[model samples]
Target: MDFTDHVVVGVDGSSTSIAAAVWARDIARAGHWPLGIVYTQGMAPDVREMLGEGGTLMCVESTLAPALVQASRTAAMVVMASRGQGSTVLPIVDAAAEAVLQEAAGPVVVLPYTTWNTLDRPLVLGLDAERPSPASIRFAVSVAGRTGARLKVIVDDKGQGPDRARLQTVQVLTRVLGSDLPETFDVEVSAHELTDALLAKASEASLTVVGSQHARRSTERERSENRLLLRLSTSPVAVVANTVEAGQADGSATR
Candidate 1:
């Protein structure tokens, strides 16, 4: 199958997984990109019924990481439900889903089964003041643009004072967005823990964007925080690669 720009979603028979598939369908339709529904083991009959027509459907009996890696080889972005089939009550991040986000070469969007509706909220971007990633910023902005939502950028203090953190975030935003920074874009520096601050602000967000902390050289603490955020987020989370791929694709890179 031609996988260029395809929206690939992983399904595991959960309602949240179906929601992810539906969201991916909308994204694929909007962008004129093909959609691919991937499942290993089994799929819900209702999910098959809900995913009526168009796009490619692949079923494999392999494990999660291998399946996700194979999907990543072809997919521009991988979408997965935050929780798995066995999850009940709250949807916490599972090992299989974490593996996908950790190793996926491209972007991975995690859809959570939140009780609270988040369809009309703003988009939140998590910026690492010590080392801001342009790709994450660009991706967040692009998504906010598409969703017609305001963009709120949050800077992780990581031990810096509020004033210093704000300056660092402003510098990174200026460097990445230039004069094109939308009037709806807002940036703030937070004194709370990265995950805590993001989650606290997530109530006002339909989606949150953060840099992928899965690289080999990333500190254990950073990786752990990212994973924790993935697990506990009430809003959808888009984990973008740290490279400037999004800026390059949109011809907005200052580099």
Candidate 2:
């Protein structure tokens, strides 16, 4: 759909969770999308209280869901986090979110339940020499579109920037429902070092998306840059798993 669509945010009711909720509210408002707050109970007492016998599971979900609907452009199930483990570390949060916001996967801005942290905005998707997962791009685009946030894809790849490979990725994005592919999308080209350029852009953007290179196959250098992004970038980070085409063995796309 459009950026006016809704975004699904995960919370844990912890201070961090609350912060996530608040952050989601702001994003929703900016993007003109309804905010969805889901409280995870992967921990304990929290989920138990919500689902334990003589618990308030039904009552709570009913009350919170509708109330959220009222106060927010639209609110949804505010249940305790569930119990599980899978593709993600926070399986509970992931599962609960997948259930409530299926087909509504515009973007899932995860606000970790870590204390003493500020939520960042104006998401910056780091364009790697290696292409990002199509699914990840789809998710990122949805959030960017909804928030009316500007997108800056960093092409830190060497060689000719994988011209052919990147072109296909670009082609797919153009077809997506919400893509503001301006003539030039904050393009960047770096030979080796990317600290200065990345820091500069990260400083301005609210978020950054980095392809999560698996250690099993990553070179010492690739691993180093990924770590650098985590430590250097000032904005919140979204680590996307590798999903580039075989042709683009190196991160760069040469058109």
Candidate 3:
């Protein structure tokens, strides 16, 4: 796919998910970029019965999938909130994030919620961990253009794991933004303090962009818990995975 103009989002069977879908679609349309959504139900027969008739949940594929595709360069994905967010401050990413963070081959944007922090403040794409893919940069650029929000490239502790990664990440970011990304992009090198740093910046920003770790989820419980913590935070979140949500076209389910 032409990732240079694609945007993806993760959705669960939650009520708030709809808002995220709508918001993502709106932004995608505004930017004229391809938008995609993903929803995953895993191998749980009970979940399949709970979400659908067969052993797999079809609500997402049949319901909200289409809308996502039509929205510029966008797609939708739905996974079991396998890990959902955790209850702690540094919770893990649920099933949805695991799939996106690990499998999404592009700069993925992990959004916790779709509709929030619509304030007219500056928008910052937090690159605390993993290098962004083409998708991530496209999402950030599209978001900034659509919202008219000043975009900042944020470097949190996650991006500074080792000296090599830190330097390489900064170099990548610099290449991504070129003259657009000013030298003032906030650099937070503290460990667990990333949450605080992000939250503090969120207070002054219209929104913050991040990636999901669930895509790399190895354990169900751990991933679920982290997603919960992220969901509970003050900032809105976006989760990206390798899958897409085709059911969104019918506009029947949430994102």
Candidate 4:
């Protein structure tokens, strides 16, 4: 089926996958977008059993690789559960979720199964302290603008260049969004570790925003930071890739 501009969710019958599907459903409903539930070909029977009913089955060779590629090609945004039910930690970005953040061409939202009131907290955007990506900021701004939600921009200066990083971040947002940046949006520069700082802020946030990694080309530190943020955040984390323009958003083909 054609899934253009739709919200696509990857499901393996795990609790996390179900949570992702539910979250995607709410988002699609809120945005008046279509929703597609995707299931890989060789997942376990229990995973299949969770289907219970009919939905578009995006049969693929691998769960994260092929499925995400297809989702990126046809979907506007892909939703994934950070970790499944078997995870030892309460929340962690599984290997599949990591691959999605690294490779997805569009926006990806990684969520945990934990419960929280999305309406009460503000939307938090975690800026890259080294080189902030304009796409990431713009995407977050778009969401906050649409939802009329308060936005918090978090920059972990730590030992990195806080002044330079903060300047670049504000410039990009102001350049890309101009006066469109929400009046409720605020920027915060911190000296704490990137992951640690974001976790603390996200604990009370409704949703956290982050940029995508450069897939195979990303450094170990880049990949680890994104993974840690996804795994540890108490709020839903949105990972926006630099593939499509922030305005012309949505996902997958293959590589």
- Compose the digit string of candidate 3's lDDT tens values, residues 133-204: 433443454456544567665555553465664676667766755654543444445454445556666656
lDDT leader: 1
Q: What clash count does candidate 4 reach? A: 7
TM-score, cand. 2: 0.48
The alpha-carbon deviation from the true structure for residue 38 of candidate 1, after best TM-score superposition, in angstroms, is 1.1
Candidates in order, TM-scores: namely: 0.79, 0.48, 0.48, 0.76
Higher-scoring candidate on TM-score, 1 or 2: 1
TM-score quality measure for candidate 3: 0.48
Please give the ranking of all candidate structures by lDDT, highest first, separated by commas: 1, 4, 3, 2
TM-score of 1: 0.79
Q: Cα RMSD (Å) between model 2 and the true structure?
A: 11.6
Better candidate by TM-score, 1 or 4? 1
Least accurate 10 contiguous residues by lDDT in model 1:
246-255
Error of 2 at 185 (Å): 2.5
Per-residue CA lDDT of model 2 for 1-255, tens digit only, reads 111233434444544444544555555555454443433444335543433332122112322222222321222112111221232454323443333222221222333323223334456766543444553454455445545566666555455554653564466456542344444454445554445556677656765655543412434212555545544555544443343221211111111
Residue-level error in angstroms, candidate 4, position 114 = 2.9
Better of 2 and 4 by TM-score: 4
Angstrom error at residue 24, model 4: 1.2
Runs in model 2 with CA error above 4 Å?
A: 1-5, 40-122, 159-180, 193-200, 211-233, 239-255
Candidate 4 regions exceeding 4 Å error are 40-65, 85-91, 113-120, 157-169, 213-222, 248-255
Q: Model 3 clash tally? A: 77
Root-mean-square deviation (CA) per prediction: 4.0, 11.6, 10.3, 5.4
lDDT of 1 by residue, 1-255 (tens): 445557788887777787888877765654455788887665645556777777577776765555765676556567888776776655377666767765676677888766363546777998886677777787777666655667888877778687888787887788887875666678777888778899898778877888854342334212766777877777778787675376322322221
